[model samples]
Target: MQTNDAFSFLMAWAAAPFRIGSVTPSSATLSALMTKEVGPDTGPVLELGPGTGPFTRALIEKGVRENDLTLIEADSDFAAMLTKRFPAARIFEMDATGLRHMALYNGPVLGAAISGLPFRLISPRRTRLILEGVFANLRPGASLYQFTLGLRCPIDQTLLDQLDLRATRIGHTLLNFPPATVYRISRIPVTKSYDWRYA
Candidate 1:
């Protein structure tokens, strides 16, 4: 999609009265807003709230096959748009918090989670709960890629502290609306959480 389309998409989302924070598409920030962790080449990939498929397009451009990607969006309007936009992708009309409830064991091991959800206003508890579900289901070496407006980190630090997850600032891209920074989150050293994948 073009930059103008991105702007229009964000504007519509902004007007939705949804909890979604920014409607701005950070296509330019897609690459920078990702962790260098999730190895390229292959693995089942999950994208949260892929508004207008901005990062979804970038992920395909970065070598992730359309079939290997799963696009999840809670917005019915946006979900319908994604279904038409990327016929090759698997679009889920659901919220990120309820991901674990969805049965997805038939695909490749989850290697990465690229979240564009409005996490700034989201509480750390809810964020941790969602991440816990994602992490528990991920494979070893899997990574969570999140873009944030604040140039500081991907997910909030206070949330990180509460979840016992450690995040490293991989990179940042200022070309996006309000700009953003990407962070890689993983279990800090060793934390008992029934999943070694996050460790």
Candidate 2:
């Protein structure tokens, strides 16, 4: 991470520790792990809370086009910085929960999403709303990659079941400050029911 980015993150965290979640920008190692599964072929990507654009840079390195990225950052300063840093990308200065009410694309065309939001700090109700919004914009078989400092998945199991979603631990990196684990959250495929008589 650059010195300026770290300073900016520190300031943001100081202002709102729960919202910023971390004292510094995400490490390169964690960013790589979060974006490894996505690339140009993944089509449009959505990123939540991309503070300082660490994962955004990683997504670019993985071959995702700048214009294909849509970033949702509630922090005004970070959103402004992202606009200047990635002029081709779309940056929204709004809370991610608003995604449920907004249409980011023509339809569910986004192939993937990367989230840096602090699920651990957010209430379960809001977490469910956020997940619902994200999945509503994702294409079939697409996933939302999230990293958390918690030992287990930050999303509650009850909420996951209610949403018909599942989370799998993709990987973890000790290099990041406080260390973090990445989870791939995807919707469970619905199976068609057959009539016993028809069978």
Candidate 3:
């Protein structure tokens, strides 16, 4: 990450720590881990709370085309910076909870959804709403990767069951400021399809 990116993240956190999440930008290791499952062949991707574009940069390095990426940043300053930094990608200045309303996002079925949002700080209801919005626009088997400072998964288990989704601990990095772990959430695979041929 660049010095300006770090400075912008710090300033944004200083203003609203809850919204900005981390006091420092994510470490390179964490960024790489968060986007490990995504690649050029992974199809279009969606990113939430791309504060300073750490993960965004990592995604590009992983072979994801800039034009195929959609970034949602609630903070206007960060969103503007991301727009300039990733001119080819579509950037939206809107809350994650309101993602369902974005016309650009509603059209495409995402291959992956990477989140830098602070789920620990958000209420369970809001978290459910955001996840619902993301999954609604994602293709079957597409994964949502999220990094959290907490030890356990940030999202509730009940919500996972309700959505028929499953979570896997993909990676953890002690190199980040406070240490972070990445979780991959995806719909449970269907074992069989029912038919009435015998009946």
Candidate 4:
């Protein structure tokens, strides 16, 4: 990680601890685990809140092309830094929760979404919207990868049910500052049920 990266992350955290989530950028071990499921063949990938590009670097190392990645960062400063660092990537300086209002991005059905967002700090309603937008753009079976400092999944069961999604714990890394676990989220197909009242 670059010295500037840490400094920038610290500044962002100092401004809004809850929004920034972590005081420091994610560790390399955690970054690797979060991007383990994606690659060039996996199609285009979306990265939410890629503050200093730790996971972004890992994804590229995993064989994903820089041009095939879309980075959505709410913070203008981090977004500007990411744009400079990754010239080929599509960087959008917009809120992840506002994805619903954005045009459908041009790409193959997104292979996966690697998030650095602080889902634990976001409200359930907004979290649902962010996820709904993610699912709307992803291909069937595409996974959403997220790392959390908490022992439990950052996303609650109620939201998962509403989205018809399931979370699988990928692995836990004690190497990180506060330790973190990665979860792979996949949408579960919902079967339509017949209503007897109509008959």
Full-model lDDT for every candidate:
0.73, 0.95, 0.89, 0.90
lDDT of 2 by residue, 116-176 (tens): 9999999998998899899999999999999998569999899999999999999999999
Clashing pairs in 2: none
Model 1 C-alpha lDDT per residue in residues 1-199, reported as the tens digit of each score: 4766676676676776345677666655555456345435747788888877777777787778888788888878778888988999888898788875665665337878888877777777777777877777667767788777786664667777877777877777767677777877766666546777876
**Highest TM-score against the true fold, candidate:** 2
Show where candidate 1 strays beyond 4 Å. Answer: 1-4, 31-40, 106-108, 191-199
Displacement of residue 144 (Cα, Å) in model 1 is 0.1
In model 3, pairs of residues that clash are: none
Q: Candidate 4 local accuracy as lDDT? A: 0.90
What is the overall TM-score of model 2 with all chains considered together? 0.98
- Worst 10-residue lDDT window for candidate 1 reads 31-40
lDDT score for residue 198 of model 2: 79
Residue 41, model 4: Cα distance from true site in angstroms:
0.5
Quality of model 2 by C-alpha lDDT: 0.95
Q: Which ten residues in a row have the lowest lDDT in candidate 3?
A: 99-108
Candidates 1 and 4, the one with greater lDDT = 4
Ranking by lDDT: 2, 4, 3, 1
TM-score of candidate 4 against the unseen true structure: 0.93
Q: What are the TM-scores, per candidate, against the unseen true structure? A: 0.82, 0.98, 0.93, 0.93
Question: In model 4, what lDDT does residue 73 have?
Answer: 95
